[model samples]
Target chain A: MLSMVKECRRTKVFKPVLDHIPYAKFIGMGCEQFGDEYIFTLPSNDNNLGNPTLPAIHGGVLGGFLENSAIIHLLLKLDTPRLPKTIDFSIDYLRAGRHKDTFAICEITRQGRRAANVSMYAWQTKQSEPTAVARAHFLLEST
Target chain B: MKENNEALADFCQRGMADIKHSEVLGIETVSASNESITLKLPYSLNLVGDMETGALHGGAIFTLADQTSGFAVFSHLHPQIRIAPTLDLRIDHMRKSTKGMDLFCTARCYRYTDNIAFTRAVLYENDIDNPVAHAVGSFMFLETVKDQGWLK
Candidate 1:
């Protein structure tokens, strides 16, 4: 009972935080948050396609989506005034992101006072097989 | 085999056509060569990361650099290759770019074997020495072929 209430309160708090990111809105990414869990969706759009041959999503778009997911999760989890600045980003593309709606889930691997690290897994069809995985570190401001 | 002039023109048109991501970013071809490709990214309000400070989003620069690297690989080995999936990519941001200034990127294909190609790119606004970001990445070529025509 208490857990359900806690979930409702978290959604109310974090939903607005996600909307403030302009790139997320520009890219047409939508989010659903419950507690610390987040599901990020990237809608299939003409602008996101990189290869006109296979109609694959741009590698940058893939990288951006995962990166944004990490930032949002960290923001919501910490409940800070703004999102942390990115330190560095590394991405490994496991497969081609075909023209379709893509989804990503972020897991916080570690957290400290001044910095936080997060890992992201993105998949289009099969959750078991991720299209790309990324690790990003961010510098947090005073919380 | 296409002459140098014809190949350069072809690369510019086909590169803009083949990659929708570049078109969306308003990438303009500055120069092209068999070895490297250079392009420009104009500043856009849509790319701003912070409304308060008016800073351009890092992702926009990242997309530009990634596309430049892919195009560099394509310009060098055009007839023999079609697709190169990125195996890994890394970008290090040095400093925030000046708002409303165009970002210039140059990508060079350092080496490639049968299955993999390595690329490095630099993003700058006014000068190459003072860069906004640096990226080193690798891609997997779908098909590998040794073109004797390319050698000559």
Candidate 2:
């Protein structure tokens, strides 16, 4: 367990918008705490292709990023060591991701003993538009 | 032996090109006509140590649904046509998957218009009788190329 936590800290997974998801290293979904905002960036890779072309950031990747953002926010605020279970996630892909790059800035709306709620917007460079938006619910484990 | 079958094989190949980056969650061969595609949960892809419990991670499941849905749409498109990111997706976990279990997913596109295509995915684990989760999603065609202003 301690090693997992250590792994979490060593990797981008412990960072906001990047944790708890697969392929973080390849996709470039890194986390940075920028003063009041928690920013997550999704870097483009070889697989992201289509008409408009994208890092091909899959919706599942976006969902994972948002979900991680929510739980990490809760973890940062609390004095507990509990893992979070995703209750539900709803994501709206507003625009297709362009090859340049993209990411999201998230904020926690509510944090309770058992559950937490978070919302975020994903913006890409080429489109300069909000490509996706998400709201997720998480259940915290007991410490 | 048929054009449709050839296409299905190609689609799966392209989808699974990057095994390390994206594991095959599940692949269900629907009818030969490319009517519907169902994929199972990708048992192998998950957090370390977490994989041992055989519990299907929600993120993996969601990614599977998205990829399956994307493939479902791609199967019907022209050879050159391809889809980008999912425009929208909503997933609900009905229950946890069985331990060390493989999941099943059935994805179908009910409607296909010029701009967007819609799909539904049903995911099951040990028992097909009860599904572990359900997902409904849509993807938009990136048919046009624009000067992505960000590059400048």
Candidate 3:
């Protein structure tokens, strides 16, 4: 796993996958390598707001970021070049995501031959207090 | 009946205007009532998730469902509440959405308490029978028990 992470870091293999997702581009989502992990960032944008009264980020935008983060994380970890197809996604909105920079990290809880489960957490100001947490299952193509 | 329809139309317009993300997605209200609300999302090139297949992003579909569900809750509550923030949402993608086709979502507030509202919605292209995704969401009412008159 460490070697794969190092190789991906050296090659910057996740760029094309992230670049190809239009929604990610539309929302201005970006990813950065952090040691052995990657941290996904959703920059503050007025178009991403759900409730302007509270000035909170849209729940769906946060969901999208988390889902995309998981997919990118999978791409970095797994050897398959094909994009994973999401089967189902569940999210818990713990707090209102302020209209600001939000970050997310994904952890692969389990990986099987054909399916993988990833859990994601997103935070705005503090990493310890996540604004939202989500889990998703994806169908991976067999190599 | 005509008066109610006009009122619903006005409500839908005002609701969509307040949400920036809905506007970004080009969402429009098809029909709305206190019982249920239906919304439409026009297909856009920017919403494509996979360029090879030209499929609509799951995030876009999820956004449609989430906004529709919130509208369902709002329509159900009508004058009682101004906004209900999402507490949690779950979406199950049945299949990839067809390219160059608009999406529709119909949502209903199945249950509500003093503090929380529960809603379910389905997203489809043309036929509701063939849905692309199904979603269930819980929203916080953000109103006090006294204001909601739950004790009474």
- Measured by DockQ, the strongest candidate is 3
User: Which candidate model has the greater TM-score, 2 or 3?
Assistant: 3
* Model 2 deviation from native, Cα RMSD in Å: 6.0
Tell me model 1's lDDT, rounded to 2 decimals.
Answer: 0.78
lDDT score, candidate 2, position A101: 66
Q: For model 2, state the Cα shift of residue B38 in Å.
A: 2.1
Reported per model, the fraction of native interface contacts reproduced equals: 0.64, 0.40, 0.77
- Which stretches in model 3 have alpha-carbon errors above 4 Å? A1-8, A13-15, B1-4, B144-152
Give lDDT: candidate 1, residue A71. Answer: 78
Candidate lDDT scores, in order, read 0.78, 0.61, 0.85
Tens-digit per-residue lDDT, A26-91, candidate 3 = 888988886788899999999999877667898989898898899878878887557788999999
Candidate 1, which segments miss by more than 4 Å at Cα?
A1-15, B1-6, B78-82, B144-152
In angstroms, the error of model 2 at A65 is 2.3
TM-score of each: 0.87, 0.72, 0.91
Model 1 Cα lDDT, one tens digit per residue, A1-143:
22333453455544455456677777778777555467888989998898776768999988888888887777656655555777778899998899999999998788888888889999999999899999888887773
How much TM-score does chain B earn in each model? 0.84, 0.73, 0.88
Task: State the displacement of the C-alpha of residue A37, model 1, in Å, after optimal TM-score superposition.
Answer: 1.2
